[model samples]
Target: MLYFDHSASTPIHPAVLKLMQDTELNHFGNPSSAHQFGQKSRLVIEIARKQMAQAIGCLSSEIIFTGGGTEANNLVLWNLLHQQKKHVITSAIEHPSVLNVLKQLKEFGVTFTIIPVDHACRVNPEDIQNAITKNTGLISIMFANNEVGTVQPIERIGKIAEQHGIPFHSDAVQILGKIPINISDQKITMVSFSAHKFYGPKGVGVLYLKKGTNPKSLVIGGGQERNLRAGTENTSCIAGLGLASELANKNIAKRKTHLEQLADQFKLEMTDAYPEIIYNGHPEHSLPGVISATFPAVTSNILIIKLDLQGIAVSSGSACSSGSVNTSHVLRAMNMSNDHNIRTLRISFGRDNSKEDVHLLTEKISEILKQHHNKR
Candidate 1:
C-alpha cells in the first residue's frame, strides 16, 4: 500500500526497529532495580533522555518520558489545574488530548479562553495575548496543527506568555521530525512529543520541561522520571525514540525539502485535475509534508474508503477520532462550511513517499472521484 497517513503514525525506521528489538531481547531488567542488569537498563534510559534532549535543545534533566503524547499533555494540564490555576488559555484547534483535558478541568472551576483561528486555521498571537488574565496561569497551544498542518506563531505566543509570567506549553508531536524545534529559542516552557509520529516505535513519548518549570506528577508509586512520571521505563521503546530523534535531527533539512516537493506536487496535480478541490491550512506557513483538501460533492468517508480500496491510505480526520460521528473540531473551529467539513481529507507524506508516489495518489484520487461522479 502507498501510505499517506504520516500524520497519524509513521512506519518505524529500520534502524530504530533494530535498536528496539535488540534492547528488548537482551535488556529486560527493571530500571529501578539496583542490580547490574538494572543499572545497565537505567543507563540506556538516561542515554535516551540525553538524545531526546539534544534533539529539542533542552537539558537532559528536563526530559520526562511518558506512555504517549496524550499522557504527556495530560500531565501538563492536570498539574496546572491541580495548582488551582483558575484560568487557562488555548487555541480552538488543539489536539483532543489538550482540548478534552481542558474540558474535563471545567469540573474544578477552571475557566478557559479558547482563541479562535483565522480562516486559514492560523492562531493569532495578539488574541492569545488579549485573553490572558490574572488567573491565567498557563497557555497551551499546538506548534503545528495535526489535521490541517498550520504552524502556529509559537515564538510570539511564547514571548507573550513570558511577559505575562504564565507558563507556555506546546504539543509539538507533529513538529518534532518535520521541522527543527529548539525549545530554548521558542521560549516555550514545556512541549510534548510522541515517538510514533516520527518513525519511532509506539508507546513512548517525551515531555520537555524547561528549567524552573515544575508540574506535579500524574502517575504515582515509583520514583521514575525524577518522580514526575511513575512506573518502570519502557526501555526498548525509549531507545528507539532516542535513535529516531537523532536521525530526525540529523536529516531534517533534507527530509523537509523532499516532503515539500512531494506535497507541492500532489497539490498542483490534484488541483489542476479537480478545480473544485479546496485546500485547507495556511498557504505558506504550513507543515512541509501534510496537506488537507476538500473535494466538492463527496463525503470524505466514502472517498477515503475508495482510496483505500485503490491501495492508497489517507485519513478523514485525526486517527484518535476516526470512528466518531462528529465533524473535525479543528475544521469546525476554523469556520469551515458543513459541506466542506464533510468533504475534507488529510493527506500526509513521509520519507518513504516520493514524487512518483504522489503522482499515483493524485491519479487514483482522480479516478475515484470520476467513478463517484459517474455513479451519481
Candidate 2:
C-alpha cells in the first residue's frame, strides 16, 4: 500500500524493530524483580525512559509508559473524575478514546462542557475559559486533532487552567514527534503519547506527568511506572519506544521538512484539480503531515476504498472507528453535513513517502473524481 496514514500509525523502522527483538531476548526479566536479570531489565527500561524524556525535552521520571494513547488518555480522565461531581472541559473533536471515556464517565454526575470547533476544526481557548465553572476540576484538550490535524493553542488553554487552578491535560499522540514538545512551558500537567504515532512498535504509549503533579492511579496492581500505571511492563515494547524516541530526536528535523513539502505539494495539486474541495483543520496551524479535505459530491470513504484498491491507503476518520462510515463527529459538531461531512478524507504524509507517491495518488484521485463526476 502507498500508506498515507502515518497519523493513524507509522510503520516500525528497522532500528526500532531490531532493538525490540534484542530486548525481548536479553531483557526478559520483570522490572519489579530484584534479581540480576531483573536489575538488567530495569536498567534498560530506565535508560529507554530517559531517552524518551530527552526526546521530548522532559525529565525521565515525568514519562509514564502505558499501553497506547487510548489507555494513556483513559488514565488521565478516569483518575481525575473518579468519584467526584466535578466539571470537565473538552473539545468536540477529541478522539473516541477521549470522548468515549468522558461520555461514559458522565453517568456518575461528572459534568462536562465541550467547546465547539469552527469549520476549520479548531477549538477557541476563549470558549473553554468561558465554560469554566467553580466546580471545574479538569481541562482535557488534545494538542493535535487525530482526524483533521488541527493543532490547538495548548499554551493559551494551559494558561487559562492555571489561572483557575484547574489541572490541564492534552492528548499529544498525533503531534508528539512532529512538533517540539516541552510540557514545562505549557499549562499542561498531563500529556499522552504513543510510540506507534512515530516509527515505533504499537502497544507502547507515554504519559508525561509533570513533577509534583500526581493523579490517581488507573491500573491497580504491582507498582510499575511509578504506581501511575500498574502491571508488568512490556519490556520489549518499552525498549522499542526508547529506540524510536532516540531516532526521532535525530531525524525529526529532516522528516519535518520532507513531510511538510509533500503536504504543500498535495494541497497545490489537489486544489488545482478540484477547486470545490473544502479544507478541514487550521490552514496554517495544523500538523505538517496531515491534510483533511472534502471533495464535493464524493464521499471520503469511497475514495478511501478506491485508493486502497490501488495500493494507496488512507482514512476517512480516526483509526479507532475502523469500519464506520458515520460522519466525522469533528465536522458534525461544527454544524456542517451532507457533502461537507461525507466528503472529508484525512491524507497523512510520512517520513517514508515521497513527492512521486503524492503525484501518483493525486493522479488516482483525479481519475476517481472524473469517474465520479461522469456517473453523476
- C-alpha lDDT of all candidate models, in order: 0.90, 0.86
Tens-digit lDDT string for candidate 2 (1-376): 6999898899998999998899999889988898999999999899889989988878898989999999988988887566453888999989898889878987867878989988777888889989988888889999988888888888899889999988888999988668777666677888888999888999999989988987878778877888887788999999899988888767677778888899889889989988888777788888887988888788887898899999999888788888776778887976777668788898999888999999998999999999999998
Runs in model 2 deviating more than 4 A are 82-85
TM-score of 2: 0.96
State the lDDT at 359 in candidate 2: 95
Question: Which parts of model 1 are misplaced by more than 4 Å?
Answer: none
Q: Candidate 2, 140: how far from true, in Å?
A: 0.4
- Largest lDDT belongs to which candidate? 1
Residue-level lDDT of model 1, residues 1-376, one tens digit each, is: 8999999999999999999899998888998999999998988898999999999998999999999899999999888666756789998998999898888988988789999999999998999888888889889999999999999998899899988888998999998778898787887898999999989989899999888877788878888888898788899999999999988888789999999999889989998989879999999889998989999778999888888887889998799986799999999999997888999999999998978899988998888889888988
TM-score of each: 0.98, 0.96
Q: Cα deviation of 225 in candidate 2 (Å)? A: 1.4
Best candidate, TM-score: 1
Q: Positional deviation of 214 in candidate 1, in angstroms?
A: 2.0
In TM-score terms, candidate 1 sits at 0.98
